[model samples]
Target: MDGLQAYGAGKAGGAFDPVTFFQQPHAILRIINWLFSVVIFGCIANEGYINRPTEEQEYCIFNQNANACNYAVFMGCVCFLCCSGLLALDVRFPQISGVKDRKKAVLADLGVSAFWAFMWFVGFCFLANQWQASKPEDNPLKEGGDAARAAITFSFFSIFSWGAQSFLAFQRYKLGADTAIFGDYADPGQEADQGPYSAFPGETVESPPAGGVDGTAGSPVGYQRQEY
Candidate 1:
């Protein structure tokens, strides 16, 4: 039963272990996701805008498409925040005693991870397309080319990392479901009620007849005739 306990069903107030926590596959992926989001948003925020000598206003470097740059930056920021929140939740997960609560948490993780993964995919494609279509004349100096490429690369990596998180969450959900089902079926109260050798209720064993061998209240017929 110890081996079969559902994830996040551990006793509360356990001591935290940083080494073990970071060693987990899911934790490692989360850290990677966090880093990727930082790289994407950091690059775009700092170097995504450029100003032409002729124009007074700054413009987005991705083909001058503000939407492209905005989309990537927005998604990246959201991912970074979400990763931080999820990491905190992961740290507290094992202390959750309620199965339903744990389930809700895992489901939230799954949905969020999946949603972010899709968003990153979209952002990567949008940014890359805009970059590819950019005219050399727009920025002849190529000031933010490296930054734009870095953002796009990290966005692409983020898609896979978030997808992996979703997969891990799904696995945890399934494991918990299986453990709950088996636990219900193995309940001691149910087993006691259905004991193998127990008789049905209200049934009684029959007693032998009170009188003679012929099953009558009087003496045997042969013995009575001899006395007479």
Candidate 2:
């Protein structure tokens, strides 16, 4: 079966194919997420701070709100790490022998991806608002403005990418759930050997008495002999 159809099936110990792995929709989204994270955090870390000749220490570029810059950086860094870990897990997913484990992994991916998507939405809004409120005097040379815009733009993109990841993970979860439900049903062919009371094949059945209930030879129950 194709890899997408085989998702969550937990068919283990298959040969690893790098080309196919990279070509998967899931893998492509993850790579996009990873790159977006790098862009967000890299921009903030490199150019989020600016200083004037009169200032002794660097101040954040987004209206001098350290919290805004910190929040973006934190989210970006954590997302970067999560994408990396998930990519590694994806590489090893085919080797997992347990369906439950694969299900758990997919569920985790769903939850984490959804949560990050929301967070990136918040980050985008927060950064954009702060950038708009920034005073021109705060950045005399207009330094890091492009970086700020890049961070905001990529944060916006990350929301959709992560959301897409969540959607894909949910699909995998559903596939696994369906597989588990169908697997629990006894096969029709296999049920032929199981009797109504679940009696197994070759089981001995008790036989009734050969004669009447009274053990009389050729005598019926209602015909009792009279004393003559």
Candidate 3:
């Protein structure tokens, strides 16, 4: 019976669920999904299934097909390799009283992540473009327009991945927003409950019982001050 009111429909304290709030971070979910989808897309593009067998078939799923899979693997490798650098940034800097320290940490990590992202972008960009520009006669996998288009598309996803990860890195690692993810940290009502509800820390809350010193009805906590 008592538990019913504790969790019942009310605006005071029942709505906020702390467990679910801290356990989940939505930003991480979206980027991982995007990375996986792009990888699979790369693999299926050219039909290079297992081994690069110069065949004249269209439905080879288990052989070296030299299709989208080859390039997808290539793109996935590069993107994750760069993403790995973000681990360093994800570490936190302890709070200092006067001078700020967290922001400095983020700036430091940003420098490292940006470097890795740039290197990965350059290597992937050059190779992908070259492969895209190659004539089909040289390699039956991708050539001319489709090759270039696919390479460019993959590059776009790669850049997006880096940028997305980089931006999220600032909030969690550098900005110290991660500490406040669950919110204020102090007691939720401690700030606003300063007047009647909370007198001062260690201060007594003395009040007469039901019919007070003035013998009048009172509030829930049993109190009645002189009216006149």
lDDT of 3 at 90: 30
RMSD of each: 8.2, 7.9, 13.4
Ranking by lDDT: 2, 1, 3
TM-score of 3: 0.37
* Predictions in order: lDDT: 0.84, 0.86, 0.44
Off by over 4 Å in 2: 1-6, 187-228
Q: Please give, for residues 1-228, the per-residue lDDT of candidate 2 as tens digits.
A: 223234553358888899989999999999999999999999999999999988789989999999999998898899899999999999988987766677788888899999999999999999999999999989989999999999999999998999999999999988777766675566787566454445456563333345756898776545678999
Question: Over the full model, what C-alpha lDDT does candidate 3 score relative to the true structure?
Answer: 0.44
Candidate 2 vs 3: which has more TM-score: 2
Judge candidate 1 at residue 38 and give its lDDT: 88
Candidate 3: minimum summed lDDT over ten consecutive residues — where? 1-10
- Return the TM-score for each candidate structure: 0.80, 0.80, 0.37
What shift in Å separates residue 37 of candidate 2 from its native position after superposition?
0.6
Score candidate 2 by lDDT: 0.86
Ten contiguous residues minimizing lDDT sum, candidate 1: 201-210
